[model samples]
Target: MQFIDIKAIHAHSAAQIDAAVAQVFEHGRYINGPEVYELEATLGKFLGDSKPLHCIAVASGTMALEVALRALSIGPGDEVITTPFTWISTAETIALVGATPVFADIEPDTYNIDPKEVEKVITPKTKAIIPVDLFGQLPDYTALETIAEKHGLKIIEDAAQSFGAEQNARKAGTFGHVATTSFFPAKPLGGYGDGGAVFTADDQLAEDLRAVTNHGCKERESHYILGTNGRCDSLQAAIIQAKFANFRDAEIALRQKVGARYSEALKDYVTVPKIHPGNTHIYAQYTIRPKNRDSLGEALKAADIPSAVYYRKPLHQQEVFSHLPCAKKSFPHTEQAAQEVISLPFHPYLSEADQARIIATVVKAV
Candidate 1:
């Protein structure tokens, strides 16, 4: 069994996708075409906002974070606070813009950037906080936002894994000063290829992001500021729009049902994931903590049931960022989680039989 059944997912909407791609070919405007804007609008509405919230399509999730930082003017000599446990892109984007990524410890339960740790790391040089919504759940934004306001820091919600997640009535991509989501095929609302979107309620920042994504020019031959070619192609946008139109809601429901089943069946055998109050988890990866993660992973592999790890090492311990400026202490919780976490085969389209088999294997392995 595969960890993510991409073929099975696309099979459900092949005809609609074909028609969308065919329309894109007929238009022949591959870069920054009509489909890109249509998808931005569609996703903006999907996030439950249109008037105030603006979406800018980018080339990748990393680009979305970079563009958001550029639009916010975070640059060299500036410090951006973030969690130690996440994909490198979360911290890599900060360094890409010549800014320092200050590492913060995470909350053990949610495995997200801890607000208290974030507060402790705040300095005059601190410019922003990029809190990742790890494993398809939104971070503790209530405390994070309050801390940002007190410190005058921008809150950049890294919703790369949480496209369909929600906290209270607000969606994942609708949080903080700006929020970013990925369409890297494995994400909750993913495209066939690399794509991402940046969201913000600030009108000027939204306008700046549009310019930043297209060589810093709103009009032809007119340059205003430094930017990159981060525009999303029409073909990928068409595929994402088609997939989102038909399967987004139903897929979200299926993921919830799947997550619940895993939690119910495996809670006794392993440490299942936890959802924060008022937050709806999308289960991008149904990760659990078995007593012996390595042994459990080996057993699953032996049984032909695939499993993976979101992050085996926290960002602070990574070789690339080891010498970078950070807190002069250890992250006990983040370190412990890196050793214990294991993601089982999880997808919206995973069959009941497959799930049962996975559960039984995990129970026996542990």
Candidate 2:
């Protein structure tokens, strides 16, 4: 009945969470505490340990992107290319860091930033590319990496929605020069409160990230760069660590099954999310496009079923970005997708009967 069923999720992990929190209370080190480092180490091992990826936990996903940009030295007079169809924070991070956010169109099928459109936007000032892993699926990083190497641009994987996804054999967070993910309560690997982390195999970059997130302190007495208070709370990290141990893998598998059920039942009535070859989608939002998106939403509402739109407007059309330059002359696909996509209630805890009811309502609506 709920959109994401967070209560059901917490019910499964409540005991483990209480234990973790009790340990936190016993120690009483709230900021950048032991639990935070434990979570980071666990995440590093989960992603890969061959090069031993460094994980830097932060206060929020937006702050993760901001810190990554700063560590990479991307700032004023530099241009960073990213998609126009994502949450505003993706592009806003670039502008906030004093860089220009160059908008690129997305692939109609996957709703990912088109690599071809990215090449057309490169100029002498272009510095980095932030390819968002939208809707729990990753962009074509192999193609994006080729483009970055040829132009000497840094690639930052905006993996806010894809913490548990994979491309080929590489985990989503291991794709670009540095990748970031959110722990917002609705995300696949969410925590109790706002949280995020940056991942990298580069040792020097890891050092910079740790320093920048901690008031730009290379050491307690030495301040070297401009930074912010971006450390992930100890309690949030403990809760997430507990949740991951209890149900993360099982939940990921359940998401795939749920996404497939939605696609099989609804593909005839609307456009289902497309998974590129060699990629595994985690279904953060099982978005679909119908010709009559608004009407379909109303019809489902009338049936006591809820539906929501992931994005109703592209960043290019937003008034705040009117002053920025765009990479493409037109975002035809991005604009078209905005009017057609809607998401039904999707959570791992949904019963088959509930899923069937949702499907029946959607089929009847469309």
Residue-level lDDT of model 2, residues 34-72, one tens digit each, is 999999998988898576689998998999999999999
**Tens digits of per-residue lDDT for model 1, 1-366:** 789999888987799899999999998999978999999889888775546469899999999999999999999999999999999999999999999999889988889889999999899999999999999999889999999999899999999999888999788898899999899999988888899999988889999999999889899889797799999999999999889965665888898999999999999999999899999999888989889988998999899999899789788888888787564569999999998999988888899999999999999988
Clashing pairs in 1: none
TM-score of each: 0.98, 0.98
RMSD of 1: 1.1
lDDT of each: 0.90, 0.90
Model 2 lowest lDDT segment of ten? 321-330
